[model samples]
Target: MQAVDVQDYARRLMEAHGDKAVAEAAQKARALEEKGKHEDAQPWRRIEAALKEMLGPHQS
Candidate 1:
C-alpha cells in the first residue's frame, strides 16, 4: 500500500473543516488582541482580514 501525501490530506481536512477553522481563528485572534497579545495576534488579524475580504461586506 502507498502512503497518503500529507499536503493532500491537509487540503482535504481544510476543505471539510474550513469554516469552523476560520471562525475559531478569528475568535482566538480577537481574544489575544483584547488581552494585549498584539505580537502574537498579528498573524490571526491578517487571517481575519483576508477572510473578511473574501466574504465581502454583508448587504442587508
Candidate 2:
C-alpha cells in the first residue's frame, strides 16, 4: 500500500528476525527484480531501501 506501511512492516520484520532477515529479503527482492518481477519485489525493495536509509551504511 503506502511507503509508510512498507517501512512499518520492515521494522517489525527486522525486530522479529534481526539483520539476517533484511539481508535475505533484499536478496530475494534483487532476484525478483532480475526476473522482471518488479511488482512482486516492490514491497521488499521499498522495505530494504527504507531499512538501509534508516540504518545508514554498514561497516565490516
Candidate 3:
C-alpha cells in the first residue's frame, strides 16, 4: 500500500483502539524479530514501520 493508505490506516486504527493497537502490534513484531521470525512478523512490522515512517522520526 501507499504512504497515504498507511497514514489512513494508522489514523483509523488509533482512533478505534487508541494507542493500544500500535503498541501491541509493535510489541508482537519485536517478539517475532527477536525469535528470528521476520517473515512471520512482517504484517505487524510493516504496519508499525509504515506508521512511524509516515509520522516521521518524532512520531512515538
Candidate 4:
C-alpha cells in the first residue's frame, strides 16, 4: 500500500484500538509471515510502522 494509505489505516486503527493498534498490526504481520504469506504481510508491516511513527519514539 501507499504511504498515505498506510497512515490513514494507522489512524483509523489507533482510533478504534487506541494503544493496542501497533501491537495488533504487528501481530497480524507476524501471523501472516508465519503462514508463508510474506506478500500479504507487507501491508500489515507498513501499517505497524505507520502506527509506531504516529505513536512517537517515547511510547513503549
The model with the greatest TM-score is: 4
List TM-score per model, in order: 0.52, 0.72, 0.52, 0.92
Comparison by lDDT, 1 against 2, better one: 2
As for candidate 4, its clashing pairs are none
Question: In model 1, what are the clashing residue pairs, if there are any?
Answer: none
All predictions: root-mean-square deviation over Cα? 8.2, 2.0, 3.8, 1.5
* Tens-digit per-residue lDDT, 1-60, candidate 3: 566776677777667766576786699889999999989887776677766654556635
lDDT of 2 at 46: 85
RMSD of 4: 1.5
Per-residue lDDT of candidate 2, residues 23-52 (tens digit): 967998999999999999988888888777
| Number of residue pairs clashing in candidate 1, backbone atoms closer than 3 angstroms, sequence gap of 3 or more or interchain | 0
lDDT of 4 by residue, 2-26 (tens): 8889999999999999999999999
Query: lDDT (0-100) at residue 52 of candidate 1?
Result: 53
Candidate 2 lDDT (Cα, whole model)? 0.83
lDDT of 2 at 19: 73
Instruction: Give all candidates' CA lDDT scores.
Output: 0.60, 0.83, 0.72, 0.94
